[model samples]
Target: MQDHQSGHQRLTLSDVQRPEYLANPYPLYHRLREHDPIYWDEEMHAWVLTRYTDVVAVLRDPRFSSAWGPVETAWMPEELRPQLEPALRAVSRQMLFLDPPDHSRLRGLVARAFTPRMVESLRPRVQRLVDELLDAVQDQGEMEFVADFAYPLPAIVIAEMLGVPPEDRSQFIVWTQDFGRLLDGGHLSFEELLTTLSGIADFLAYFRRQIAQRRTAPRDDLLQALILAEEQGDRLNEEELLGNCVLLLAAGHGTTTHLLGNGLYALLQHPEQLQLLRENPSLAPTAVMELLRYDSPVQLTSRRLTADVEWAGRRFKAGEEVLTVLGAANHDPEQFPDPDRLDLRRTDNRHVAFGHGPHFCLGAPLARLEAEVAFTTILRRLPQLCLATEQIERLPSLVFRGIKALPVTFASVLPATGATAAAED
Candidate 1:
């Protein structure tokens, strides 16, 4: 509930959802951390948690269930559940929304198929994609960083990783944008809900068709490997397979794109941090970690109580919603000294940007790799890069924080690099 005390200002998450706050919500996060770390809000009908310790506790505790309630009505508005039964099940079965045994089962197979080895192998490919993306705008001297670099870099990586056809990558990008709304919108508006439904339907059809084809003619990709993940005479059901595939497609790309976009934007905003990284290339990894903490891509995640539990001197009943303000937690003073400052060399950082415990993002390593590669390449290659416009549009998403477009200009370094190279001469 909104606090309307006369002559005394107070705020809530809804206040943080506006355009002004979206652009810069860290201050509000700071306020939450200092004032109401475990606030009960009537509007959200959830315990709004802002402290690092509390957010981590909720995330790691087994008392909290990630499973969505009633699969049929989970994906869309209550009224639309009848028509979207199949689509709802597909979404509801995703490991992101499951708990314990089911979560462990799906995660085991995915972890096996998408190991750190696989991510390490993509380093060269990710670098090439970054180069190619930058090369496309090398002559223009200006480009929309989000559309040109950030979006395409991760989109291409995820597409190739999933065995999505080279030609079909464009459509896959469109589908991914639609799916991102499922998480980012909180509760979707009618039009947005319809778009999400349509996206899920298309994805279900495509995943099923692809799974069927892969069974007939297996490919050497993550999807194929997942389809083949057989354990103790067990395997993914059609529903599980479809759900996880769609989950991978949606999660695999969108978060990384936002990371790239938000990380870049954060650097631009704090030129000193950008300068530090540019001068010291070895700091790339730490810089990425700092960026994730500085301006996290995924800002909020939720959990439901499975049983009544007492936490932080408060009682929360079973099945109650707990809203973890990840962005706020990342900036909690208790967790990080000088929480507002952008320190690329931030060492004690344990930000919950990717959450924590069982449901932590599987693609965290890959996202980190992409950010490091992207940041390193951009700094090394485009030394003259600068923002073309001060106007940066944050994504219309509560969960995902990213710029709509980061217009930028840099000196064309193509001729020098090209002129220095002579093919077999």
Candidate 2:
């Protein structure tokens, strides 16, 4: 309701591109929300869309494009352009990062593997994985929740879906960790960015080898479905296959890992809610939704204006950079009252954590199921669980907010009866 253009045009890049803001963006977000909700940054030569509604509108708006660069012009810095040109060229083929028609096509091709029935069919399997993970954590007095529980739940689920062998999960851990590091806009040095690009090359090499094997000898898994997916003689090209694989690995793993880690951290911080959850196991379904809304894992997404557009009495030029702050949008007072408070019992909570419109996450059901199983199993089995470390360390990426390590200590070996108990020794 407040739009004042007179004094706001003096905004500089330092205002939004500060390292301190990355550490705790909410304060800067508050300032921006109050003064200039949609301001342009000169340093990055881009516009920033911060207000909750504005961010959501941009994400759902087709006039604002998802495919920003890396097509004829990759977005990488000029210094490393020579080294990364090949890999950066493939970035445009990714489904989440692509535009309509292509985005819709690639998303649809993979949608069959993630249909509701397929996700539901795996519930029992997911429950088993959660049980096994929780049982291992229960035998120890202390555990790093992220490593011991959070990271593995979704990593395993994604691996199973992609037909990755159990032993190869370590590869995914390395790839995902490196991928996360390269995304740190505030902290990623040139060397680290190149390292991530190198890792991508390695992953592509591995995927190519695997694709060859899968193509010759198909299996009953998602990878096989991808390999065989053909519509009127249309199939994924080599670059598209590799790009989608990277997309799946990056999107599928990071979000779910943070979802579990962020959710459990919230529960531990709020003991009353933890106790309530321990008392009612059936509340897992509702609790997962609250967890997503309270502390969304993926904080922001980027877009570029394909054409000049006006909204809320402000005009944006074409080819401008727009950052949709999902974290802030999820906490907007206009949309969610007491946006700072976490309400597990709230009935009418509609959040844009997974995004909105055409960009809504395709893996929502699977991620939800995994979190439900992971959190319920952790809380139910380890009632004595409490933080072993006073201050948990978060991952260094601004785009993804998750604990790098969550040191938790428990009173005893609270193993669920009849469940296999494997010590974390």
Give RMSD to native, each candidate. 3.3, 4.3
The local distance difference test score of each candidate is 0.81, 0.74
**Residue 139: error of model 1 in Å?**
0.8
Model 1: pairs clashing at backbone N, Cα or C within 3 Å: 1-42
Q: Which parts of model 2 are misplaced by more than 4 Å?
A: 1-24, 70-84, 181-189, 230-233, 417-425
The estimated TM-scores of all candidates read 0.92, 0.88
Per-residue CA lDDT of model 2 for 197-301, tens digit only, reads 877767767777888898778889877777776312466766778778877876787789889888988899899888888888688888888888888888777
Candidate with the greatest lDDT versus the true structure = 1
TM-score of 1: 0.92
* Residue 60, model 2: Cα distance from true site in angstroms: 1.4
Clashing pairs in 2: 70-74
